[model samples]
Target: MTPANSDGCSPDFPDEALAAELDELRQLLDGTDKPACAEEGEGLVIMRLCSGLTLQEWEGLGARRDLRDWMALPITANPFPYLTRIQQTLKELVFLSEHDPLTKLHNRGAFERILSAELIRSSRSGQPLALVLLDLDNFKTVNDTYGHPCGDRVLETMGALLAAEKRTYDYAARVGGEEFALILPGVGMVRAEGIVERLIESARTLRVVCDGVDTPLCVTLSAGIACTKGKVAIGWEKLYAMADEALYAAKAAGKDRVRCAPIADLTGTPEKTLVRADEKRFLFTGTTKG
Candidate 1:
């Protein structure tokens, strides 16, 4: 007594019901009747009906994306197609707003937003946050001698290196031309020192060569770090100012070196390690291992 078709897998409607459906379909195709517009999920069903006269044909291409892609084309006029594309475009726009187009890293605004959030989280949890600012040493000379194109390659290499090497929770951003920032949440001074040292060492060896050039170009980094001392503290502005001060200190000492914001002002009393491309320097505790 259950409704079933000859296939026995689908409910079979009475002849009258089938005839009524066929009449409605015929009227729709003839443009004598029009169905109300609907959303994408339902729109897919309607599209299948429009594309195929037979159930077998609809089943073949029903789930494929060619239909949606075809619908978004310039020649298509239906409004339903715009629904899917609108969603996709909005996501792309959000990403572009936060990311730098050249290096494909988070831009300065995005970095500040992330840093502000992390400071709140660090203050609440009493975990340390390390902020590092790195500037390319002798960057003007590199650009003047090698040209801007080669300089661009150097920045790209640094961005890519930071993206690949930083911890998963850390955030990397291209804050300015030849300038980059790293935000490490839940990381303290000593650990921050090791992390920054490793990053600079890795960057030191990257070979950026211009076309028709045999020698690899040298573009080194001078870094400064400021950390919240395993305590509840730091407004975003204060944190950035401290890091900037540390960065300039590194520049004044010599190029291609790492410097930390004075611990007396911040937090933690651990021996600080400084990484210089040439000597492998350390401060406070003073040990030269390299």
Candidate 2:
């Protein structure tokens, strides 16, 4: 994908520089290549996991929490066992409907619906969110090298990797035959790339064992990242295009690395949307330039 510039020059993305800066911050924050969850760090996580939930989904989560408390009751302690059992059955049915049978991640239909909801939520909250499009590199080769059964196993492993890596607020989905996506609410581009980079590190070491063989094989992935330009909400289609373009860049540049959408020029720009009241005062009261 060609990187877009403010002046319509070369396709060099504006936010390209932020990657290194965030990497440095990542180093300082964790002192390692690993990604940390919100509870593990002060910053660097999404705003909230339930930001984009519909009324029904929200109530479902509430019911889930309530059930967890009730689940702890002794077998003989619960007078009405039917109630918890019914809820559990409903939750299971919902899960089966919304999630892919293989990867156990959100299926394409569910993902698109959630994407729209998330964009709206991000817009209302006035915080940036990221959408990442990822494809397994040379996956056909892996399938050919092993077998279709092995290919399915690889897909399953990737699904697990995605689910394991993302925070509770983030969303993971299998959107295509081999294409997957991650929706990160309230996370900007810089932090988004950092998260995906750590995912890359983890995938680099993955070795899935196939049937009838002791030797395990590895897989590499290419990811493209796009963040909301600012508080202004763009359609999910546009956002996906930006991420798809970046994904093209990753594939063109070489597989197994992450690329990002063009960043809006944050330099010398007034902080209207994402700044605190005190920070806005600080911006207005900055040292006068000569």
Candidate 3:
């Protein structure tokens, strides 16, 4: 009598007998060099043979004697080529989504995502974070005087400058046509301000050569610097607006300067007051109260 089959074994066989049969099959496959072939109706199954089976012995094990004639058929079931193309397309899409085409900097969308994540980490770890909004002074003049090409060059130069000055952990990107934003994680306002000052000086000293002559082009930048001192729900837009206002003040006073206003100072309502002194009437629009 045949032994009973074990769990999950074929129902036709008893356990000990099925185990012995499986062992015999395994030995037969292992002792053969060529794979065992089996044909069931229209499908062909190939089992990898191990060591010593010849073509004749393999053919003898086939379910149908005529299966040997179908052994030369090629396999056509792998989808790896199509999957590879899909993977490549996905990679290109990811790159385009995350990068700015103009300056090759991280795009605003990417910047916002990264900034949010960084802010959370900084808040949890009690680390300082600095944010700077930078605008090119009189950028319109550059475009008007030369051409759009010159304007593009200036932008590329500015992007390169930021890239050079940025630390490994810092995030610098072009957030607008004439505006750039920088995120300095773990940096305080004081240090951030110093970095901005250095950048301004660098921009002022940068010279562009055109038409075989060194064109004396001076670029001035107005920067607004802020830092996260404690846990707060302050949005990046608010910080950017504050910096922009400070930048406008710098331009109004004179171009080529860095103006930084504290978050507390930015909360007050701006008042419009006119001062008449001698023959001159000056309209001052600012949050400062005298």
lDDT of 3 by residue, 173-248 (tens): 8888888889888887788889989999998888754332357566778887766753554566666666678777
Compose the digit string of candidate 2's lDDT tens values, residues 174-283. Answer: 99988999999888899999999999889899998889757898888899998874556567888888889999999999889999987532322444557766766767
Best by lDDT: 2
Q: How many backbone clashes does candidate 2 have?
A: 3
Deviation in Å, model 3, residue 67 alpha carbon: 44
RMSD of each: 16.2, 25.0, 20.4
Cα-based lDDT at residue 203, candidate 2: 89
Model 1, position 175: C-alpha lDDT score: 96
Model 1: lowest-lDDT 10 consecutive positions: 44-53
How well is each residue in 1-290 modelled by candidate 1, as lDDT tens digits?
Answer: 11112342233333344335545655676684344553333442322112112232322232232222222221234544455554665676799899998788999999999999998898777678899999988988888988888888888888999999988889999999889999998788899999999988888888897865679986678999988854545688888888899999999998788999864234433323435534535563466655
Per-residue lDDT, model 3, residue 180, is: 86
Model 3: C-alpha RMSD to truth? Answer: 20.4
Task: Rank candidates by lDDT, best first.
Answer: 2, 1, 3
Those runs of model 1 whose alpha carbons end farther than 4 Å from true positions after fitting are: 1-82, 264-290
Against the hidden true structure, what lDDT does model 3 obtain?
0.66
Report clashes for each candidate as comma-separated counts: 0, 3, 9
